[model samples]
Target: MSLTHLPSLHRPASHGAGVRHKAQSMLHWGLSQGLPNVVVKMAARKGDLQGLLTQAGSGDEIWEVIDQVRAQGPLVKGRVTFITADHAVVSEVLTSKAFRTGNPLDRLGFLATASIRLRPDTMHPLVEPSLLVTEPPDHTRYRKLVTRVFTMRAVEKLRDRAETVARELLDELEGRVDLVEQYCSLLPVTLISQILGIPTSERRNVLAMGSDIAASLDFGLSWPEYRDVDAGLRRFDAWQEAHIETLRKNPGDDLLSQLVHVQDEDGTLDMAELKATAGLVLAAGFETTVNLLGNGIKLLHDNPEELSKLQQDPALWPNAVEEVLRIDPPVLLTARFAPEPTTLEGQYISAGLQVVVLLAGANRDPHVFEDPTRFDVTRANARDHLSFSAGRHHCLGAALARMEGEVGLKSFFDRYPDVTLLPGAQRRPTRILRGWRTLPAQV
Candidate 1:
């Protein structure tokens, strides 16, 4: 189908006047976030797992909450959702047909639901048409088309390029640097940009947009914060539309260009699906790897013995990436909803109820991994982490992220074996997506 023949894309309505915009923002914050925050905080005071998760700021803090959840049982009831930290239960929820991806506000009562429905122009990665929340047969179709473009062989082709970029990035480093900014973020963004055929000149803008849009995943965003996130999404959507048009005229060998032309018996993707898939690929393509690289660097630096082992036996680099993911994952948690009444691990879940799976906690389940808290590069089951999630909704860029982590971390450590992590490293202040905001290191 011709690009013009496809369905018209839905763009978010322009921001209203100052007073109106402020009022809308306040309404959105109160119903969609403010009220929910109040409830979760109340639960947190009572030592509830769901509330503790919202309050968790660091890896240590989150793990403490996870331990409390685990102690409760396989499935624990929370104020708004069902919470699970057990590895078996988490795995089941992610893979089962009984559960499906859901919005956080689904169970936040009538006001929250009505608030979302009132905003028809809302756009975010978690919204439908984006593969993150899309269900089959649409999801099945989208995944098939996207997978064809991101095949293992396609990712492997970028390996040599990734290594080259890592080497250049490291070579340019001098005494002190914020590795998160200078190295970790650059490596993956550059690779993902190339994958999407984004021009070098536009990459910095794209990175900034992705960073802002990422706030959509977090809950309880303040009025200004939500406004900024909405603006970023709109900017990205506009740019993506223009870029798709450009590719239609002058297609290249990039995965995105391939996606533009990909077809099957179901025909082709409409403009909305195209934008959603492409936008997701661009954002998710780099976000996880950026975190993995930052987290891996800190994890290895703290665990000198593991670093020494990797230096002694280079073959362990792959498993070292897995170990980092298990011990300090990029994504802390994800939620699944019961489309209908369902039983999981003998716990009956009412229809429309949400299940928040603590992936970081599940990765460290004592039943699944021995000494779950310890960082072991050689741990045989390290790859079994739910960091990239699992089952049908598993991260599409897992292989690419793993490749980037292995190549990026190995290259950095191999070059500066005596690298020292300086003080003042700060973790990103996000609860769901975890990583360093600034990781200063001296080589």
Candidate 2:
């Protein structure tokens, strides 16, 4: 059915209902008002977004669901109202000036407490106004300062360093290891720690804390995971405070020190801003890159033909990496908000509404790429994928990520040309990130 044919319902002028009821009513009404007919039909058969997510226990199932939504049109409605599985629509939504990466805590009629329930640290000022949750002047200002230190030049300066670290880590590996833990996870964390100038004595603790913080990026977490995330933030905050004082008193040549000393006409970053910036870089730098390396190896292992092609012509490794990213992106879901009432692909999106963009779906849309599901390392348009997102909020660490993925994967295969993945590899159980949790393999 077309978007205009969506059912009309009486919307409450005032959301006086309690949080739970208000959210349920708002979600149901949004579906009726803005959801695609296909989504409504699916909900009738398998319940709503939550049910669908529960049923999609594997990556393949999630891809199938996304394909179904794409078949209906460019857009559908999930619980967050406007959702798109189409590649073109996802690009348009991400790049449009009218749309903003508004605060998720304030959108979708979901209580701020809901986010708190996921990870209580979001309520703290030290994490709340960071680039991840900002718009306009704030994002513009913060990104400008960061760009000075996080430039392509800066990343290039570390390329040789990262390559050295990758080689060293691979050398330390034994006959058999969980690649996820031994190499894939360790190399990135170690490289990022070095770049951030984290104390050598505190690197292990900081790595653990960073992992918990990264896990908290998922839509929600288990009770145990939540506690771990909360505790991680507390420890992370304390570390940042001590380091901030240290960097302030005796500046060094590290990113954290640069961030500490960075100043503009509006003075330097405040204490909270400093903490938030450091936390953001540390968390964002390592998390997704680990997935990229893990996911790339896993995909290549599953497709021997593609792997052989890369092994034969090492020049294809860069393109292979792009195809890997296109096939299995790291971050799965991102949202944008309509600052004013607008029409998206002919569907009405009210002001202050959340529109969830599924990057994995867009990467596989048949409308954009021929044989979208096939794992072809030689795919020419592979770089067209939105794995690092788009527009102003496009990932700041993208160049660094690409460099790491290339170096890390190449060095590993060179070290163990005949390495094979063991059975029983496990995937992370989270809505936002998509990659292996444990990938045992033998050299």
Candidate 3:
């Protein structure tokens, strides 16, 4: 998605008007983010669980906050949203019909909601049309269509290809490398691009666009950050439109091509819906898997005993992937809203209340997993983790992510048994997505 041919909506009106646009963007940020951040900060000082979750820095810090939330009980009130760390409560909130996916800004004031709604051109990835926020009939139809291409049988057909991609990516690495940029990121991006029929030459550009737009999942953003993300979204929009047209004219044997031509009893998806689905697949197809791979590498590196267990019994690879996801998931948290009054774990939830389910926390709930904090490869019931969420909105690509995580991590370690994580590794700054941005490694 290059910016060379962006539509007028994305382009500035005139040289002088650039300053006016900047001022408008700043104002928008102030209403949509700045004020909310101030409230959160104040709540943090007052020891609010939600506020502390946002302020938590490292993985240890995040776990600490999760422990605090758990100590409070099943459901705790935050400054803006309800908080839950109990596995049972989190599962109930996600699976129950009483709670539904909603816009993050629903609770914010009218001015803040209006500020975001005013910019229809810069579509937030988490907003409407995207599968993440859609509910019921439309979501059901979209999921059915997407499910045809991502079933276990279908994903199994791609296993050989996934293995080949992982081997090829690892073959390019030398003694020292940034595992994220060179291996972890490339492996899944390459496969997802193939599924989408995106050309090999365009993968790097697509990856960059995905990374920039990923920040949209977080609660707040500064003016500069939001501006850059908006630009990236515009570029992606332009590119996706052109690509869809190309596919319409000349289809291929790819999942995207199938989506372009597939039909149901209710007829086909409109252009906008198609773009939203395809874009979600493109971004989501890789973003989390990259994290899974990186986290697996770090976890295995830190626990040589666990690594040795896998080396001794290659069959444990699949279960090890679950353990990695359970121990250090890619996504930190997700929010759900109660459409109507609901009762959960004996607590009454008022209508329109937003419940923030900490997936990372739920995965480590002691009631669910024994010795929750330990990174045990052989732990029973590791697959019970909420890393892929649950119920209606469960990850459509869960099977594929597991395949990629297993193939990518296993291939990396088998190729470089002596590989060690270097000191310069850094985590991504975004609060929602949790993973390493740069994982320096020595083979």
Candidate 4:
């Protein structure tokens, strides 16, 4: 659609002062700009997004601001505007209800028609192929095949495997460790190998190849960088092909074999659908999890008090992880396109225009939340955050990601009681994947 609007993260999450500050900020923005698709410029003269967020909502009270945007985001219209990632329209599309979210899309477009341009100029090859880029029926059907191998029951069966990888990563953390490299990288890589039945021995090769594609997200390796992109894809496809071929010859007790057996009333899955399922699961299951783990840890370190509280009471860490997801979700934007012409907040919309939703913003809306800015883990509504997104395409691996985070964080704090950030490597700069390339951690 030519149009406007999106989903929510409305909340009233505070006691008093925080709420007032957020309310005032929301009122100011409402009066000034009246909410539209604004681009948030962070690299500013003065702390940038940090300053803006502090002004409108206490990190604890961002929810209310998020709520206001959800209730009234249609009026906004800018190719790019400035706002925190956790604002109103942003969060609404995340955490499962995004498709139904109004004002965002009303014409037959990418989201409405499910014709994801797996070849968008902005989308990387690996990224475009994932289930996130598809819509219902296809997405649901393909995901069901992969789900057969990635069930909660199966993931629970993977706890030992997960912890084993976590512990190995911890063991590698000596005097200092690139927390992202050591832990975040390990679990997902190991999980990919385990799931694909790609043999632990070949994991390093597979991961090394995928890492280039993953790094492309932060570094931008698109059509312009087709050579590097194609090279990485070629390498991965070769390895995957060899592995898949081998699995077909001698199947084992892993995801590939299980998927091979997956069938419903329609008999076995088609080749492309099966590949799509495996490909999305393997890549997303690994890449996104690593980003989530890294981002979650970096967030805790960014807020020392929160980290300290988490360390002191491990029970609080789970909620803290949820808050981290809300505060700085790994995948910040999920796209949609209108199926038909529709109007939103006085704006006329036509079919075929793509509208992207910012999950981070919805988590910080003001109307629903009292103080939508502060990062209080104990806050009752912390779990309501939309990092996993909403609607049919909600993250299928959410439960798995949560379990991994809870275990990873708890295991981490138990070992390094006095964890602190040093001069670590910088994060990859990307609007899509929100995380660091490296974050130094010292005991």
Candidate 5:
């Protein structure tokens, strides 16, 4: 549980010309062997996540990178030798039964595990595995305990409440407001908090702690930031543990309570499993949904023609949501490791190596959609994008997120047909998750 050995955010200084030569050599190897895409190579040398984020901010650049990699082949080595990114290859890798989540021994080592604090119970509580990190049959077992509850039917039951929460939050907006703070961000956390049965009074604490914990997924962090994150996680765990106890004594219809009371024909989840599951649900339920709403709104604003189309026909809200997701998904990247040596798109992938799938990039692959970069709400196949990911690890709350987005966006335009994006909207700097930090809007 100690954070004594946390890694620094910046990439360490290389040891003179020898290291520089080695990096150059790696870059050459990538190009010569048709390994990584050009952007990945540039990112590797810089060791700058900010630069990479900036590069991906434009859809055309992302598709260009994906196209460049596709030309080389379906699979190519990434900026890091151990990583790879290919649009077609990534799609296959995500769905293939051969690939799995988590690589036991990665370059980041303990620093990576400690950085996130996945397991908070062991001597190395930082290495704890949640649903996102576990491989089957462990993943299967853990996922099974909650899968039924996340089913479309189960989540649909919350649609009315989700809509109510969104409408009420938007109804309070006056003239100009920071949509990210006032509406998009508040709605998801408020909705998830209610679902977890966290008291209305304590939801602010939950949101703060959840934000801190969620930042752990960003990976690169300075010691001071990690210290703050570590402290926040400890507080979060303490609160969740106490809440779990309360649920045990006074179970309700909430998801957390259901998790607490769930018993299978084979057995039941242990306390550690319960906390891990609940923590993932709490964090995942809101973090991505907030981004989905913020990102979707931004996309709409950037494309006034598309926004007009939606304004003209409110029924297009559902399809518009999918297009928004396609153009700008909340989750930008996801990775999977080869549990066993396998071949993808005729390229040999070694066991334990990782393939970092650029979900947003894949969504814009030219082969999949016409005029890939255009934000067209009527695009019939927009739903096929990998925004929610695919296969065993596809987002469990996707249905709920979609419904919330549909209701939120549709209702917002209905109430304020003249809403427009204010200048100076700011985007969050985090590397893994993409969303606005301060998206100002005027009604």
Candidate 6:
């Protein structure tokens, strides 16, 4: 349906009376481990000018678990508290102006709690904690260097190689193969390794280790799990440091070498910044694209007509990719720190108090996205989705991701025009990134 014809959240449900009632609100849920947490409701539920969202206190695992508990509720009309900003907050958070203000991620605490939930650590225990999770100056310095190498110019050059990677992976698929494991997961990792000059032999080991570290942030890990993740980080860092050392003496064409050797007259990146940038690019490039391809394919499975349209005219692949990212983004919500006591949505977020912006919720805000829930490929603003985030923290690898998705999807349909989802396509267990750890489908 056209966005204008799409139903609003408040529109009476097509179902029988009483079926349209919203889900439970101001949820009070608890974690099995310890304390209890209460979710504050957001004014976005009511489409207020100021986006007011309720957040559970970060007192302990209780809050983290509470968010996890809330994540389980219906994706639509989930019980919510005003602590987190709702759709009322999308324009501010996702607009380019937000980033130009400088250090938007840290300034707003975009989704710190979510980050904490993913990996509850006082310090950044993970290697190269995303610029999304870091403060500016701290984030900006490194981000600048990474962008230079990962720019559209550079990423476009890798298109053919990415296609080869996709093709080679698809050729190896067998009956009921996990599209994610065999195709999606493996493709980006290998691609990133190639970009960074890492050998293919180490891709699996690095990816597994990366997964362990990334997984520690979700569902709240135990002390031992945390330690194990930390250990894995050390190993990855040590290995990267060694590799970086090798490049310093004998630089190559890989992305890492570019960062190491590329210099502005003023000197743009430092060693620490270099390592952090390289690590983040490799991890984010691989992980985000992996989820994007898997999710895009899954979306095709869900919307066959859309798939058919794309199959008929691969040109739609670009728009289809945008629609997919918007509708089913890999990263859902992000937490930002309030740099100062700011008033938004008629609510005061005190300085240092963390504010998490629900991108998933904001993307579905009827005001910005006409019929925010209904999936529409031709929607003029479908690309406006916060999947890449906006402002200073907009995804650095977005261009690369887009090119990869466009090429990956186009190549897939060209190769197997009749491809269809198997009876079941696995979904990633966590809510942070929406994807399949395993997708068993046949062409």
Question: By TM-score, who's the top model here?
Answer: 3
Tens-digit per-residue lDDT, 283-327, candidate 5 = 667888888888887787678888899878888888999988888
Question: Candidate 1 clashing pairs?
Answer: none
TM-score comparison, 4 vs 6, better candidate: 6
lDDT accuracy of residue 341 in candidate 4: 57
Task: Name the lDDT value of residue 351 in candidate 1.
Answer: 86
- Estimate the TM-score for candidate 6: 0.73
Worst 10 residues of 2 by lDDT: 1-10
1-443 per-residue lDDT for model 2 (tens digits)? 32222234224546433343334433433332223334544664654553365346446678766766776678876664667878888899889987887554454444343333333333232245677767778888888877754578887888898889999889888877999888888877887777777777877787676666665554334445545655666778888898889888988778888889887888988988888777777766788888999998888778888878878999998888888899999888787888888888888888887787888889988878899989999998999999889988888778778888988988888888678999989897766778888999988
Between candidates 4 and 5, name the one with more favorable lDDT. 5
Off by over 4 Å in 2: 1-46, 49-51, 54-58, 104-127
- Cα deviation at 179, candidate 4, in Å, is 1.7
Find the 10 residues in a row with the least total lDDT in model 6: 20-29
Candidate 4 residue lDDT tens string, 1-443: 22121112233455554444334334323322222212222322243332232233223233444344344443344332223233444443233322332223223344432212212222333343357666665566666766655578877887887888788778878887788766787788788787778777887787677666653432212333434544565576666666777877889888787767766766775545556566667766776677778877766767778877876888887787787776667765455544565544345545544355556666665655568777777777777777677666667777778778877877776777677879846765443566677888785
Q: Residue 263: error of model 1 in Å?
A: 3.2
The residue-level lDDT of candidate 2 at 239 comes to 81
Report residue 367 deviation for candidate 6 (angstroms): 1.8
lDDT of 3: 0.85
Give each model's whole-structure lDDT: 0.85, 0.74, 0.85, 0.59, 0.71, 0.61
Stretches > 4 Å off in candidate 1: 1-22, 104-109, 120-122
Q: Candidate 6's residue-wise lDDT over 1-443, tens digit each?
A: 42112243245556523222211010100221112112222343443212222221111222243344234331212222223324546446444222222123233342432232333222232324456556566666667667765688888888989989888877876656667777777877887888888877888988886776664344334445445655666677677778888888988888788888878655856666666677778767877788888888877777788877776776677888899887777776565445566655556555555445566665665667787667766778888778877777788888888888888777776776666677666565443555667777776
Instruction: Give the 10-residue window scoring lowest on summed lDDT in candidate 4.
Output: 1-10
Q: Estimate each model's TM-score.
A: 0.93, 0.84, 0.94, 0.72, 0.82, 0.73
Local lDDT at 84 for model 3: 94
Which scores better on lDDT, 5 or 6? 5
Give the range of the ten consecutive residues with the poorest summed lDDT in model 1.
Answer: 2-11
| Native-to-model Cα distance after best TM-score fit, residue 318 in candidate 4, in Å | 1.7
